[model samples]
Target: MAHTTDETLTVLVYSDDRNTREQVRTALGRRPAADLPELDYLECATTPAVLRALEKGGVDLCVLDGEAVPVGGLGLGRQLKDEIYGCPPVLVLIGRPQDSWLAAWSRADAAISRPVDPVALAEAAATLLRSRTAGRAPATR
Candidate 1:
């Protein structure tokens, strides 16, 4: 569903590190675009938490940290893409531009590097959000 002007989009951000999650949240802000709905974030610090959130649905976009431990976001993104029907568009944060291939392998819709640039992250996130909400207003969170 395409997000309406007032509906808040549910964004799932996954990372073992809290700071990384915070960075992502900060970069994306409450509304990436004047045309889009406000963003509401769900932070996940572990794999199971991520899955649990996804299973419940309503996630418009996912920002995954590629450097997470035990299980990196790249692998997790791939798993979610395969396991979750209608999986939300994924925007992965990698350590380097060279890792873009990994993000592609993970089936992420977009990829950006660490030391997150707010402009880039916001742009990428907005693009994915738009793609997901292309034809219907997003379901309320």
Candidate 2:
């Protein structure tokens, strides 16, 4: 898949908290890296919304909040990896650095601790996006 400059990649941001979703969108801005196409975010505050968006397809990446209530990203990420065919790369936000092992268990492509450092989030997101666009398999554990 060749992406042109005009193409905008779709990124799915899943969190029950509106603030978390906003933080991710703001941190990422219009584009995470200059080499990648601009991003179009599909924000989902509920699990059903997330499922619908993903099932409908065209999501290039997933950013899930580990602290989200009802269902955390770690469990959700694991489910997506297990269930969704050709699931896009997942970046999970963990509560602490120590939870990186949980991220590995979830099978996320990448993980970052929350308080959502803009720089780290951007770097991780850009890396996953690059892999997605480049037709490379997303890294596992």
Candidate 3:
């Protein structure tokens, strides 16, 4: 089943490697599930680029690359959770399956392993977005 969003869901993918970022974009673009309309990916290859994009204010979810050299996605995810107000749910891609625990430690909403699976990634993204959308409240604290 193809994924389709009710409204456009802006996804931010953070990876230092150009190929990894492109791979993610390709995965998302290929087959949007029935749930989410075609995904709109905002790709970022640097920490500052991710932050800068967020500041402009259109991201609905975040997919981060945990294996990125230097500053990894786990660290980036944690930083966004801490610094960004109402930080969006984060999905981290761990190159090592063993590091799934680390993804939990980073408090990521969900994760996908590297050598990515387009279907799984799309499903996970859709699930997380649906859960988040369903959890919204009236802003009364």
Give residue 79's error in model 2 in angstroms: 0.2
List, residue by residue over 1-141, the lDDT tens digit for candidate 2.
Answer: 445666788889999999999999999999998877789999998899999998888899999999998999999999999999989999999999999999999999999898999999999999989888686432232
lDDT of 1 at 17: 96
- Find the candidate with the highest TM-score and give its number: 1
Q: Summing lDDT over every window of 10 consecutive residues in candidate 3, give the lowest-scoring window.
A: 132-141
Report the poorest 10 consecutive residues by lDDT, candidate 2.
132-141
In the predicted model 1, the residue pairs found to clash are: 1-136, 2-136, 2-137, 2-138, 3-138
lDDT of 1 by residue, 34-100 (tens): 6788999999999999999988888999999999998999999999999999999999999999999
lDDT of each: 0.91, 0.90, 0.80
Ranking the candidates on TM-score from highest down gives 1, 2, 3
Count clashing residue pairs in model 1: 5
Order candidates by lDDT, high to low: 1, 2, 3
Q: 23-137, model 3: which lDDT tens digit per residue? A: 8888878335665545677888888998998887767789999988788999899889889997888999998789899998888999899889998887888787776556442
